[model samples]
Target: MSGPGTAGAVETEPASARAGLGGRYARLWTASTLSAVGDGMSLTAAPLLAYTLTDDPRLVAGVTTALTLPYVLFGLPAGVLVDRVDLLRAMRGIDLFRGLLLLTLAVAVALDRGNLLVLYICFFLIGTCETFFRNASQVIVPSVVPRKLLVDANGRLLAAQTAGNEFVGPLLGSVLFAIAAAVPFGIDAASFLLSALLLSSLLGVRSAKPSTRRTGGPSTSERPADLPAAPGSGVDSAGPVSATRPGLLADMTTGARWLLRDRLLRGLALAAGGINLVLTAGLAVMVVHAHTVLGLGSIGYGLLLACQAVGAVFAARLAPRLVRRLGDEQALVCVAATMAAANVAVWLVPVGTGVGLALAAAACAGVTWDVVVVALRQTRIPRPLQGRVNSVYRLVAWGAMPVGAALGGLLSTAFGTPSVFAAGAVLMTMIAACLAEGARRRWISDPR
Candidate 1:
């Protein structure tokens, strides 16, 4: 999971390794896309599977709740592990583990032995692995591709992720599920295996420095891509030389403090969290909503969601241009408003044309938002703290999903899915207003 130009592998690398970078980057991109496809398949299959097992809104939400809960629990620890572990080895191993688990689940389902309890356990484990894989994936990118091609490479990867996970995966998963419930998971398992195989091709990507914590080397940056660096420390040939590494709690706190210390970073984190809170609320129950409110079959529901991915593809191409045109703050507001609009459409119009278009708009703007945010963070965060700070930022943003999942279930139970959508729309609008105000005051300034 090493990504482009953040922190992982030292800034300097040999030209020989950088030669034929495209092929190497393509392999990593394929790995990422394949894994994303599996994730998308699960997003559709897992909740739908839960619904098949039970009719309770709360219980169905529990599936999503279980999947996301680990981000809050294991995120920082996983970040610590990523810094210490070999990126390719860790990614390949995790993929194998996930693939085996899914293959087992597929077999169980085929045998009619699958149960909700088993689903919960499998999902939790998969989510835990994903926590590590995702973080590492980002860190490993810069190591594989040069900085000049970094943005283009990431954009391509993101596009592939969107296409596989959202466009192809959901539609394909729904079709497979219709043919046979075990089929989607079977494909997901295969996808992971393929991804693992692809990881072996990354011969050039290496840790900037092997982490001393695990390698018995000198201190360095604690990123999956590099060794742990002390606060204000410079990169070293032997390893990072500054203060000695702190305990886990203190190390994690240091990363968190760095992010919170900056007003813009703090605002961005809060905004992302708010966005996730409402977004998860809708997505958690979207399958059910599509069934009851929109009166759509699984195929129709899949297609409806696919529109978002289609729009995202376009967004991926244009995000950099849009950010340059609008600047960061205005662009952030656009992202928030677009999401709000999508939820509003869901609340107001249950039909395909309206909801699909709105969702697509949301997806489009959301990606632009993502591109801007990630690019900004890459510029701002020091390479040494990239792993830790990225984890902390995600810990705040993604932590909202579990809470939103639970709240979504509660809201749907109390007032139905439309109400939840309506509430999300309102919440997002308020968030957009706040961001706009901040922008007007020049609070959310560009890090560069």
Candidate 2:
């Protein structure tokens, strides 16, 4: 059952209706899982190729940065596009485009003609596609599944993401790359094709739109109950009367303004972005640590990544129960504190044993934040603004990734890899402290 005072269709879903998560949501889940496999393989293979192509840690990290920079560049624009288009068409088209790009990239890699510039272009284009794809995935959920299941559904999506992209995808990619440099990417491309086909078949499909309110001059009255709620926003999901289309500039900032004005969302966005910065930094900086400090090979490195992913998989499965038992804020404190301590232990404990265990523990605990926050956002944000709001939130949250990646390179260059990981651990701990205080003060609340 949903929590009391829940205001959406998700709140009123009967037990019988709850079963739709497995049936309808299963299609999306499967589509996401297949897509994640492609993402996982490409993610592991790209970095590996970069490492082989150049010995410079910064260049390798630059590859990571290239993939994430699109969010900083095109996130808001893509969000605006998503708000006004068919959700499946947007996702399906991106998958097709990505597949073609990957296949072409695979050909280049196979011919040994691929260079750093070429790689940067491919990663950037693909990353840009992903920004919309990611947003669409979140936006489409409510149209398919009831709100009561949002937490579980999102958790399941993350678990599949962890399993495919992080664990299974990377593991297979390592093996495939050993046989042929282009094989993993080729497979990834094919996976996208398959993902597109799957998305093509979804029932009850809805075009992605901002949950807009109609305006007559300024001073509009309260929203009528018949409009479609904003996509992905849980707050206005109950009725279907959509909001009026505002100016393009106004539409773009609508989500951003909503995010900034809300205290809970503001706090959560900060916490999310802060952690992304540190984690992205870790991705770049820690690869050096894995190689130099831990003495890990490419295969070993893939396995090490899998360890964190495996823990995240478990966390995705468990987060819903934890949130219900502890409430969102308490769950975040416990999970964040555990992850912080685990990150510190990554450096503190003996290199080989501690590194693996610490990463696993930290990853497991860390996913609680994503599961909780995603569910919270799904329920609370108004549907008309979901896409734009998510984009702006990501603008702040995910925008930090590129900075972290670049900074990781610079920091590792200047302070050394160990210091980078240590710094990340410290920052994570501090973020946790701030979140704990905010939760204690009840800064995060229903704002939609």
Candidate 3:
């Protein structure tokens, strides 16, 4: 399957027909966007349902924790599994599974069986599936699109997610929840099913050649052919074979090893993880601020969140251009700095409706940081290791999210919302400063 000019070839249709974008890439883009919108709806609706049912702030935080904790626990293993599986099949399976899970929740809600335990269990399952789907999608992108188009592809994906899922999805979900909690869940379930169908059609479309070299070992082509295969048989004699078996723990360890060995990846993961922690903490507190401090009802809070999503949308749109002009490393530094500045700015705002504007600014910064960083990572990481690296990164970086949520709740309860915002701002600034200095020293380079 390896041939001259084949390595970087794009699988999509003609560029002219795509309005200057690459061919079938547009279809994939649309599918991803719709999927994101659906995901966004669930992000909003799930928490709202949890809160409505329990009316306990701790329980609400716990629900949020349940959703994110998988990144810490299962991300590495999921990455390993992605590498072993058929990328398309894995993605489609995850989407279908997620859809079914959401449908079950919808049924539960309709049947008045939506208890805390059920919600928590569903949340964990959904999070685990998401880890696999996300890793597979990132790994598969370079195969479907030309290497030169990677930044653009990543930017489009981010924009769709920010606009549809984070912005529009949440807003619509909130509205639908107002009408009926089950409605948003139904929409979420449908979106995942649709995404699964689209992904399934893409199966066997592009198959990546197996890496001849193992980690820290010589190329596979260079090795003696008669050497026996590894014990688990992830690869088949017929050709490059997909991992069809379940070995989540071993897979996770593989991801962790990759992260520990790569210096650039390690730094990037640390920066991302730190920022994620702060972001989650801030969000946890914001819910309370919107409700109690601002005296906004659920609808008002949803609108404020929608505004934040709008800011993120704008950031996502602008990130690719900034990266092109400044180069990936510089762009990442700038985005991180911007996020830190925005965080500090939010802290300075007077309490109440003014805080909404502050959060909007912060949201823009956060989105820019997110898009650029993800694009850079996707570009820099080796294709075969993308799943493992992403998983490990998520495990370490996102591990703090649950803790952040808990802390945010505690601080809000003790020192109040202002203190939470202040603490988050300080932490973000420190992280930005560290990353900026590291980037300046050329510790991280643009893979392009």
Candidate 4:
């Protein structure tokens, strides 16, 4: 099955139709990278600050929990909102809102007023906006690029994201945090403001408007008065829903029903959820692990993260080719197996260099998995349902992060830091087995 807007068209288009990702994609890519860098800085700084306030592993991990909790709480509603609104406008507004929030946090920190409560509130709000922002971004990509180039486009985007989010951003953030503890948040605030300015230029290229034609069958009236009007029609395109429009509950049900009826997507979401639950568990206590077992400070920890980012960039560069050769189903299985092995290696080799190498391998597997799954999801989902379905899909895929982080904190508090990696290896091995069995049973399809 192909996306209603892209896949069918890709099948008929000539080889000559292959073109560069174009100017619009470039702008979106830049804006997304800028935002990712800011997010990375904030993420690195937040945990470091938490570590300063308290030595409790659970408290440190709570920062991560706050940053991901909103996905589980509001993923469905965010999907509905993303589907109903103009994506560019929504993203611009979200960037500005998040910038203001970070600015406030920066001031709070500068004034020596930072506390665990304040940090949690700030992270939770940022995470809330992230749910909508990430969904809207994914929904807009297919509109900007050809479906046949989905793998290439997604791989480049993932690479840029890794460089900014993990490589440059975290390294810069840790250095700044060591200076004053407030500089990183201030810098992140500025990045968001700049990103919003970049997005303001793409409003006229193509309006990411939802399909106004009602589902169920063809109809003479494709444009409904209750739906948002197309861009530049001299109407408020993303105004509040009219009473005649489908209610929020109805919209949510539509997306959920579509996802549930698709066996491959449903199974993928469940497997991803399980994998994330364990992966996040290991990551949540990484700060504690670095301090207690590895004897590393902030700079060393940032370098450790940089190792993973470098591996991710390398893998993202190769993901498109790998997918083309191995096919999507096989590539996914390979990623799962690789990740399981990497986690076990970390458990076995607890030294700084050995663990960093293992982490790099895990990051490589992670980016490969992301590029394949995101492209598959984008190409397979319908255009109008992109936001809703992607959100519903990620509701399981990403919503497990906070829960896993919390579990990690509890386990670390009881069993010690090294145990987190050992436990993650076991869980990931189980995920790999399930994925292999699912492939054999034909629950997953190759999107070649």
Candidate 5:
């Protein structure tokens, strides 16, 4: 009883067939899940550790800013490095580096000698490592799974991240912190180590290459041996073809050109950037609202956040079918609109212990939109340039986060907590309108 476009009806190569439950993809998925868990632990633990050390809200905020700065500064270079290296090796290196860094933080905490300067430095280094790791992982996905299963693979990754990192990671971090601040750091370090081991085992698996060859020349199989290599040639004689070693600026420009030239991708990127700005602003003010406005303690705030994660986990599972039924472009627009509507509800709602309910609604909308946007980008962007395109997309979208955080803080201080949510609602509404207009033009209709 397969439908016209059902998973069962998709054609694929024998070796590239679906890796169902308990298969190669599952193993990779596990490694990704473990890595996400470690990431979640660090995300919560790092800010908490900073707060415990200085008891200063500004310092806690500083930790986030310092970490994110690397993405703005080194994102393009990181993309280049990811494209150049063996993706699995790069990820393994990131895990090992992150493990050692977390261990150092754990030791600092255990010794009761944790300093703000040291914490900031460590956070910055880890963030830089994460930038590379993220780019590499995006590159690795297509290599390990068939083209037909890309959406499913991405869905699994998103689900694992939402479940393990978002839900369990924070809850675990909170519990471990109650026991001893050092414990969460130690567990995070272990998870990273295990992730490295799993990634190392994935060596010798070659991913699918891009359809177009590099600018320098084609492979011997593509061109006759009697034909001379292109001018200023540097071929590996035995390896596959590669693009010329373009400069960082050129590489970045290449990515930008591709995105701008494609109307759908450009519109998608802009919409994502706009929505992320608002979402980050809402998140920045949420903790303060829970604590001061709603009379909830830090633990309650954490629990509410965890509930948000749970909502996201369910939403990710539901997004694909929703998109297939509604059509990707229309579904994305609806998701964006839903997020806007949810934010408005949160803004208008009364502050009470019922904050969890409001937060859950917002999370559901956010997560649905996030899943749709990610899948859309993965399908539309070229495989070889995924790293660069992802970097560019992140550069524009994530670049708004810091501004949002700062603005949220200022708006909360000026008007109050509700103002932050109101502003987020407005921005999200604008994003929804933009997406809807794009869909009407059929700009985001196809897999291109």
Candidate 6:
């Protein structure tokens, strides 16, 4: 039974149309998975290389800060870029450029000519590319798949990302790094090349323009259907549309303005920023923790990541169902609370027992947040403004990462590795409390 919402040509429709997530979406998913593998490998290898170059926890954490700084610095403008160009071509070029960059790094490492400066520069540039690529990719989803299937599509994507980047990539990277430091970089480069090839086959993709008039159902209205119940949370009505393209600064401002004016999105973005800050704080010095506290080598560290990833993948598979069962508002509260508890457990428990279980639980909570919140954004934000709005959202959401990395390093140096988890637990608990109150007041309605 083909419904009005079925995506793609009528002839190619599945016997049960709801079963298909759309062919274009599948191709995007595949390319994303391949790129994730490359990302996983490079992320694993880069920090390990940095640790070898410097024993200082702060310096090692600097590598992470260097990588994430771009999110704060260029995130907003990158959304403007995404809104301006051919998404498929832009993504392809970025992948090709990243592959070459990694290849150069691999050669440098192989020649024993690599230095921390070079690593920082490479990671910074790559992170800049990531800023653009992520916005473009997210914007493309609504165009390829029907709106109703967003949660399912996002869930599948998150699961693949967890499996490839966290599970397969880290495991492979560790083994390869053990053999030769350069090998993982080379493999990472190859994965990017392959991902670029895959993306080349995706045709006729572009960002849609925002429409003032409502289309489809009541859900596509100018304002998000649900507003937070918080008193004084104001909703801004749509402004007059400009026919001519706005200046770059103006375009960026417009997106930022929209996000700030919307209470739910503003709150969500702010909360996400806090959560990412704490999450990265714990993760930035994890290598040091694994080495000193857990007494693990590179391979063991990878295994730890894999264990968390396995839990994330499982949770991603369950996310859509869980969201439906719990509703988006309640899901957010639960995720925050669970992450808080998990981080606390990690701080107190041993690696063999409480730590592993805690990491898994935390990963599961993280996956739930991704599936619920990201899908909410996709559903609520107009397609035309997705890039800018999302970028503005990330400017807050991901911009905190570098600062968190720095904090993690400082905490690790001053109080030891376990302090990072303790701090994260405290911060996440506060967030959970706020979110729980929002849920109790019926702050957000599940767009689904």
* Top candidate, metric lDDT: 1
TM-score of each: 0.87, 0.82, 0.76, 0.81, 0.78, 0.81
**lDDT values of the candidates?**
0.75, 0.71, 0.66, 0.73, 0.66, 0.74
Q: If candidate 6 were superposed on the true structure by all CA atoms, what would the RMSD be?
A: 8.2
Colliding pairs, model 3: 13-23, 13-24, 76-252, 77-252, 84-243, 212-220, 273-397
Error of 4 at 53 (Å): 0.8
Q: What is the C-alpha lDDT profile of model 3 across 312-334, one tens digit per residue?
A: 65554576677789876677777
lDDT of 1 at 123: 86
Question: What is the model-wide C-alpha lDDT for candidate 2?
Answer: 0.71
lDDT (Cα, tens digit) per residue for candidate 4, span 1-448: 0000111011111122245877777777777677767777788789888888988889999988998899899998877765456678888888898889999999999999999999999999988888777766765676677667666665566556666777777898888888888988998898888888988887764544554545211122333433333212223444432323455677677778888988778888898898888778888888788878888888777778778777766775577788889877778888888878877776677688887888888877777787777777877776556656777887888889999999999988998877777788888888888877766765546422
User: What is the Cα-based TM-score of model 5?
Assistant: 0.78
The TM-score leader among the candidates is 1
For model 3 the TM-score comes to 0.76
Which portions of model 1 miss their true places by more than 4 Å?
1-19, 146-148, 201-205, 208-244, 446-448
Sort order, TM-score high to low: 1, 2, 4, 6, 5, 3
Q: What's the CA error at residue 95 for candidate 4, in Å? A: 1.8
Model 3 ranges off by over 4 Å: 1-16, 19-27, 142-154, 204-258, 261-265, 317-353, 370-387, 432-448
Give Cα distance to truth, residue 145, candidate 3, Å: 5.2
Cα lDDT tens digits for candidate 5, 1-448: 0000112111122222345423556657777777777677667667667656653344555666667667777877776665445567777788888888888888988999778898889887877887777766755766666656776776566566666666667778776776788888888888888888887777656632222434322333433342222211233445455445455567678787887787766776777677767776767566566656676654565676677776665565576677778887788778777777767766787565455676666666665665566677778776556656767887877677666766766777778778888888888878888777778877665434
**Candidate 2 runs further than 4 Å off:** 1-29, 141-158, 201-228, 231-244, 317-327, 378-380, 439-448
Q: What TM-score, to 2 decimals, does candidate 1 have? A: 0.87
User: For model 3, where is the 10-residue window of minimal lDDT?
Assistant: 1-10
Q: Put down candidate 6 lDDT per residue, 1-448, tens digits, no spaces.
A: 0000111111121222354876777777777777887788888888888888887788888888998999899988777765445567778888899999999999999999888999999998888888788766765666667778775775566556656777778898887898899998898888788878878887555333233332211112322222111101122234333333555677678778888888888999989999989878877887887778887888887777777776675674577788999998889998999889988887876474466677778777887887778777878786556656877898999999999999999998999888999999999999999998888878787321
Clashing pairs in 6: 229-443
- Residue 27 CA displacement from its true place in model 1, Å: 3.3
lDDT of 2 by residue, 278-366 (tens): 87887875656777778876777778777777676666557778888888778888876876777687666647667877787777776
